[model samples]
Target: MGVRMRLTTVETVHEEGSWLFTVRDQYGADEEVVLVPCEDGVEAWINRCTHESQRLDTGRGAAMRDGQIICPKHGSMFDSCTGYCDNGEAAETTLPSVDVTVEDGTVYLTDDEVSYLRDGGIDEDEDEDGGPSSTSHLSF
Candidate 1:
């Protein structure tokens, strides 16, 4: 068990399809995590797709269908509950897990490798100027 930091309410995650948050890893690098509703509770995964660096949820929310997280890049589907991809480009890969727990309707960040920073992706103001945006490679 690690430091339990409050994230957001479980109901909020369900309403948003997914919740995005930022955390700082032990190495001092910032990472994004997404929370999606599951059968038992909410599951958190590193925001990027397993096949590439594309973010699964680009701030607004992740595209979810039939309980799976849909990759916006190549349409790969990952199980929201398990983060496992059985088909498409991401097959055989699992989204990096970020340990989280839900208790009394509120979510908490419990991963020892990361410390909660803030909600949503890294702020643009905090990013290096002139650096490419995360979605710059997308055709749309």
Candidate 2:
């Protein structure tokens, strides 16, 4: 399990929508995770779409319509609670889920593998901004 970092209180997050949040990994790297409201509790997953590898919440947050995370590119809909994509082009595929725990109204990532989708799967080379780039190859 990774360090239990506080994400937010349950009161602040609503059940009808999703929130795109970032957390640092064990190596102190920023990882993008989406916190979605579910029936049992809040669920977390990597922000990348399973079909085309695009950020699920890119332009206007996640496209959460009719209880599904609809992929903007291919319109693949994933269940917010189970990370199951049973519709659209990527029907058999599922989004990568992040380990999370909620205690005392606080949410946290509970594994050392937590991380944002790194550009090129993660490289040590620093970009011009003096920081690692989060860009990743997207197949269309």
Candidate 3:
């Protein structure tokens, strides 16, 4: 296991509907990860729909119903705990997941392929400023 970097809290994930965070992949590209409440705890997945590469959470929150995350583009519902999509255009597909662990009510980024960058998606000025913004609506 690699170093676990702090992401967010379980309380915040529940209170905010969802939590979005930025991470730098092994290839040095920024990727967004969304944390949603699950039956057990919070589960983190790459913030895009599998079928169309559409963002699941568009700076607000991913539409969820009955413990499933809804794909806004195609209405595919993904199991929040398993990342599995059993119907719609994304049927039988699973959203790419970003490994995370909850400890002491806090969430940490544990995926070896990525490193925590900031608490939001790719910022508008990220390329210009060389980093993410300190605050964003998508963040906790």
TM-score leader: 1
Pairs of colliding residues, candidate 1: none
Give per-residue CA lDDT, model 3, range 1-140, as digits (tens).
99999888899898887998899899998999999999657999999889888778877677888899987667788999999999988899999898998989998889999988888778534246433222222222
* Candidate 2 residue-wise lDDT, 7-119, digit = tens: 66555555536766765565776766777777657788777777766667652456676567767666677888888998776788878888878897787667667643322
State which candidate has the highest lDDT.
1
What value of lDDT does candidate 1 attain over all alpha carbons?
A: 0.85
Alpha-carbon shift of residue 88 in model 1 (angstroms): 1.1
Residue 49 accuracy (lDDT) in model 3: 83
Residues 95-117 of candidate 1 have per-residue lDDT tens digits of 99999888999999999999999
| Overall local distance difference test of candidate 3 | 0.83
The better candidate by lDDT, 2 or 3, is 3
Residue 23 in model 3: shift from native, Å?
Answer: 0.5
User: Using alpha carbons, what is the TM-score of model 2?
Assistant: 0.70
